[model samples]
Target chain A: GAGVSQSPSNKVTEKGKDVELRCDPISGHTALYWYRQSLGQGLEFLIYFQGNSAPDKSGLPSDRFSAERTGGSVSTLTIQRTQQEDSAVYLCASSSDYLSTDTQYFGPGTRLTVL
Target chain B: AQTVTQSQPEMSVQEAETVTLSCTYDTSENNYYLFWYKQPPSRQMILVIRQEAYKQQNATENRFSVNFQKAAKSFSLKISDSQLGDTAMYFCASSSGTYKYIFGTGTRLKVLA
Candidate 1:
């Protein structure tokens, strides 16, 4: 792909339902990142994936939040039993490599709304 | 833990004027990077500029330049000859050699016609 791509640009779900957000990073990029942005807030670090090694899941907020990157290309962010407070825009970004000082390119972001 | 702060929530400037957005960050690591990103209403996060912690010279890209004071932990964005297209939410972020970027709350800039 020319740039990072996120699926379901907008999602509205019930509070108790689970939702999945997807990200397709640029082809050949080795590092991917996920971030959440609440209303009028800055981007919050969520998770990071670098070339198939163990992901940096320290920022997942809770055990209910989990993410995985398949084949080091596409990724998915799953939220279990979504809560109203979970409503926010989920962003995905990718860099050519973790070691490169190059800036990370961002996707359009998925706006998740939990009712 | 690293933290980024943007003091101004909202700012307005006339077209062709100049405006500066303030940002300060706290980090323990000596090797790190600072960045400024812009998000328009369309929801696209665009990279505006970046500064390396070891570099004393600030980073600049056309009308956008940064004043990075490592000693003070201050990084500010100065928009010269501001245009209506420049009106957007600007964010300041920091990353310690680790890839995770810590972002500030963001400052909304409006260029009045």
Candidate 2:
């Protein structure tokens, strides 16, 4: 089975620029998650989508961060006007369902560097 | 809100020896899930083991086991006969019925051969 996959393994951009990171969850996975991992820091939750239900946006660091999961298969995290502080590894994950008991399969992640 | 904590920042263990990584969490939910995830330098996160909070019996997957203390809000992962391949950053996480998960700071483990 194919694992979760992310696009542009590495991205370098100037401050105040916008970036879009894509994620392709495993086939049939109805749950998708986005997280940010800063240098030497733990994975920080960003957002989550479960089927057609409303996405959880509580973890988004700021108003500049937003995500959209279209067709219940793929997800995109958009960081508008990115700042140097936004430079980090963006990870995507998916599971069988939204159940807490299910294990989330992670992607290799996109390392976004904002200069 | 839930929080997970890993006290040890780094730990080194001799190959084939046993090592345990400590994790504690704060949560109000009674029935949930605890997980140990390993992220190597490759940046792929792998599930090491998992424990159901309601289950009294500890969860074990071959050489990897977990000490789940629901009352104390603690969960620790023990690795026996460690291998160099086991060297990675280990993160402890807890989640309730919600899809969101809270992760610990992570412990960097080094297996010396």
Candidate 3:
């Protein structure tokens, strides 16, 4: 079975620019999540989408971070006015359901380097 | 808020040897889930094993097993007959009755040949 996949495994952008990172979840997966890994900040949950709607957006670090899932299959996380601190690995994961105990399968992650 | 902790920052083991990575968590919820994920140089997080808080017996998959102590809030991963492929950054995580998961800082394991 094909696992979750993310686009642009590595992205290098200038500060103040906006970048869109895409995530394609596995077939029939209703639960999708976005997480960030930084050198200073181990790993932090950015957002979670159950189907096409997001229920918990508190994990987002700032207002500049936003994400959307369309048709409950593909999701895009957008970051505006990128800062140096925003340089990190963006990871996407998906599960079969919205169950809390469901195991999540992760993508290779997009490494964003803000230059 | 729940917090997961992986005390060991790095660990090394010889091939075909056995190694244990320690993990502890703090949470108020009685029912939760514990997981150990291995991320190799490829950068994909792979699920090694999982343990349910309600289950007294630990979870195991092949040569990978977990020592889960609910009372002490401890969950550790043991990899037996370690191979070179076992080298990776291992993370311990928990979801305390929530849709969100809390992950640790990760332990970089090096399986030396």
Candidate 4:
């Protein structure tokens, strides 16, 4: 089975430009997660989706960050007016369900570099 | 608020030796799960091991095992007969009733050949 996939493995954009990162979770996975890994820092939780609804969005660094999961399969994280501080590796993970015991499978991640 | 902490930022261990990475967390929820994830240079997070809070028995997977102290709020990962392939950044995470996980800063482990 395919693990998890993220598109545009690397993206470089102007500071004010908007960028959208896409994630394709494993088939039949109902739970998805988004995280940001800043340089030399740990993974920071962004948002989580159980089915198509996001139950937790408190991890979003700012209002410029938004994410949505559609069809309960794929998710898109959009950053509006990106700042240099937003430059980091964005990772997506998925699990069979939201159960605490379920293992989360992770994607290779999309490295976003804001100039 | 729930928080996870990895006191060691970096560490090195000789091949075939044993090393333990320390992790501590603070959570209000009594029922939860603890996890250890390994991220190599490839930037992919891999599940190393996991422990259930309700179970006092430690979890073990091949060369990896965990020392879970429920009362002390400590969860440490022990790796025996370390290999170069084991060199990576290890993250400790905890999740309570919610699905969201609180992750630690991570520990960079280097397995010397």
Best by lDDT: 2
**What is the model-wide C-alpha lDDT for candidate 2?**
0.95
Global local distance difference test of model 4: 0.94
Looking at candidate 3 chain B, the ten consecutive residues that score lowest on lDDT are B92-101
Compose the digit string of candidate 3's lDDT tens values, residues A23-95: 9998999999999999634579999989646457888999999998888789999999999999999999999
Error of 1 at A8 (Å): 0.8
Ranking by TM-score: 3, 2, 4, 1
Which residue runs of candidate 2 sit more than 4 Å off their true CA positions? none
Q: After best superposition, candidate 2 residue B100: deviation in angstroms? A: 1.1
lDDT of each: 0.94, 0.95, 0.92, 0.94
> Rank order by DockQ, top first?
2, 4, 3, 1
The DockQ scores of all candidates, in the order shown, are 0.66, 0.82, 0.75, 0.78
- Model 3 DockQ, alpha carbons vs. true complex: 0.75
Winner of 2 and 3 under DockQ: 2
- Which of the numbered candidates is closest to the native, going by highest DockQ? 2
Residue B44 in candidate 4 has what lDDT? Answer: 92
**Model 1 chain B: lowest-lDDT 10 consecutive positions:** B93-102
TM-score per model (chain B):
0.99, 0.98, 0.98, 0.99
Instruction: Supply the TM-score for candidate 1.
Output: 0.96
Error of 1 at A25 (Å): 0.5
User: Which portions of model 4 miss their true places by more than 4 Å?
Assistant: none
